[model samples]
Target: MKENEVNAKIKAAQINNALGFFILSFGIIILFAMIFTETFIEHMTDMVAGLLLMTIGGGMMWKAKINIHKLKLNKTNDNK
Candidate 1:
């Protein structure tokens, strides 16, 4: 891959990984707070919200992986 594309791919991967971890961590925080707060209704709502956040994060990671794969394929084709 070109230098710029390579850098872009790496940055995208890092951002995606960071976002995913953040989502997962936020989910954990929600659960922890629920345990301490004793607000059962709010607790379940937080859990569902957390799940949605993590799902979005997972999608970001998947997109990054695909972009990286495409970049690699393009590089290989360029070499040929």
Candidate 2:
């Protein structure tokens, strides 16, 4: 791949990582808030939303990891 392509991929991956971190953080906060809630219904709702957000965030981070790994492999191959 070209230098510009590599740079773009790196930038995209960084964005994904940042977004995922924020989402995961928000999910954790929600889960913590669940501890202070007064009702079982609210607790269950928060649990579901929090878990879903965490899962999506984790998936995004995982995708970023794969992209970075692929970029590294491409770089090594180019050098070889």
Candidate 3:
């Protein structure tokens, strides 16, 4: 109900989304790799897209984790 709780929930949601995207992106690359073995360029593109998605998702997940940790600490302090 309070600010920290709300923020923690939001950050948790964001983390879930980032992770989901990251996993899905890899799944796409893997599927394409099998389907495009004859095309080197297509494989490269798939790898690049997968890497980009992973980088972006990782950053977002890191930010969410920091926020979640801060919220947890605040909650702990409030309880004490």
Candidate 4:
């Protein structure tokens, strides 16, 4: 791959990692909000939404990690 393409991929992966963290944090906040809820339904809703967001965020982060590792491997191979 071209140097520019590699650099772009690195940037994109970094952005993806950041976005994943943001989403994860939002999910935590939502879960925390459940503490103030008075209704069982509201609590369940928050739990579901929070868990969903967390799952998506974790998946995204895992994908980003794989992408970064692949990029590093490719860079090393290119050097060889």
Best by TM-score: 4
After superposition, which runs of candidate 4 have C-alpha atoms over 4 Å from their true positions? none
Quick one: best lDDT, which candidate?
4
Better of 3 and 4 by TM-score: 4
lDDT of 1 by residue, 1-80 (tens): 48687768778777877787777677667756665656778878877877777677777767777876877777677878
Q: Rate the local accuracy (lDDT) of all candidates.
A: 0.74, 0.89, 0.68, 0.92
The local lDDT score (0 to 100) that residue 70 gets in candidate 4 is 94
> Lowest-lDDT window of 10 residues in candidate 4?
2-11
The ten-residue window of minimal lDDT in model 1 covers: 29-38
lDDT, residue 42, candidate 3: 74
RMSD of each: 2.5, 1.0, 3.8, 0.8
Write one digit per residue (lDDT tens) for candidate 4, span 1-80. 89789979988998999999899889989989999999999999999999999988888899998999999889889989
Off by over 4 Å in 2: none
Query: Ranking by TM-score, best first?
Result: 4, 2, 1, 3
- Candidate ordering by lDDT (highest first): 4, 2, 1, 3
Candidates' TM-scores? 0.68, 0.91, 0.58, 0.94
Counting clashing residue pairs in each candidate, in order, gives 0, 0, 0, 0
Model 1, residue 56: C-alpha shift (Å) = 0.9
What global local distance difference test value does model 3 have? Answer: 0.68
The local distance difference test score of model 1 is 0.74
